[model samples]
Target: MPGLYHICYLSVAKLSALQPTPELGFEAIKEKTRKANSAAGLTGCIIFTGQHFLQVIEGIQEDVEDTFGRISRDTRHTDVRVLSEGPIEVRDFPEMAVNCGGDETLTAEALAEISAVLDYPQHQLHIREIRTLLSVLTQPSRKQDALLAG
Candidate 1:
């Protein structure tokens, strides 16, 4: 019933601020993403910023990681950067979705702390964006909560 998942943010190349392409725009592929993931039984979130794509895939660890590997080789995009990848004791996300405005800043220290927060329950945590989610968990203020969130 529970398994690991992979969370990564792919920073795509630059695009027009005034007029961006649908492939890179966060608002352009909502329905398509949801339908595709739903059909494939793959749950994840895709954050598009008209430049980069932050996708979090949650499923059986093997399936999710394999999918990430597949995406890395996909010829549809140019740049593919891996933000995070590992086996979570629990599912950080149990479904596929996407959102915009994930502009929170983070540090290497915070990223390390976040590594412990991924095993949290959906409602016990207040994090929505991937960056902030990792930052908050890594914070000392959140260290204690990580156990509770888990």
Candidate 2:
């Protein structure tokens, strides 16, 4: 069996004008994504900062690559830049296809961090920055654990 892998990317959201409302647009995307990811046995989280999207996907190497390829070609996203990716000993989100509903403050902090590093040369992003983003973005997983624990 192939080892586990993950890919993290950031992109700007470009919603079509035809969508009746932003909530509807997001809900549609979330439903579609949930189905697709679940079918492919992939797991990850998607964070939307009102205008941009930060996502992390993990699974078998081929599945992760295939998912990222589709995401890169999707028209709703622009300026899709990968932050980090590599083999992982374990999955950060083992049971979730797409984690959502994060704390507002942490999401805002994550957006600020990503924006600050957006101008930096892609290769120049420090490991610390990547770690920080992962830590904050995965906060929802912790909440999920607590809810299940209770």
Backbone clashes under 3 angstroms, per model: 2, 0
Query: Per-residue alpha-carbon lDDT of model 2 for 1-150, expressed as tens digits?
Result: 889999988887776631666446666777888899999999987766556667888899899999999989988788998888999898877878877533443445545555555545664456446544555456755633533442
List candidate 2 stretches off by more than 4 Å: 102-150
Best by lDDT: 2
Question: What TM-score number comes out for model 2?
Answer: 0.72
Name model 1 segments beyond 4 Å from true: 13-20, 23-29, 95-150
Pairs in steric clash, model 1? 12-52, 44-96
Give the TM-score comparing model 1 with the true structure, all chains together: 0.51
- Go through the candidates in order and give each one's C-alpha lDDT: 0.51, 0.71
| Per-candidate TM-score against the hidden true structure | 0.51, 0.72
Candidate 1 local lDDT, 90-147, one digit each (tens): 5444533433223232333433344334323352333345645533433446644653
Residue 19's lDDT within candidate 1 is: 29
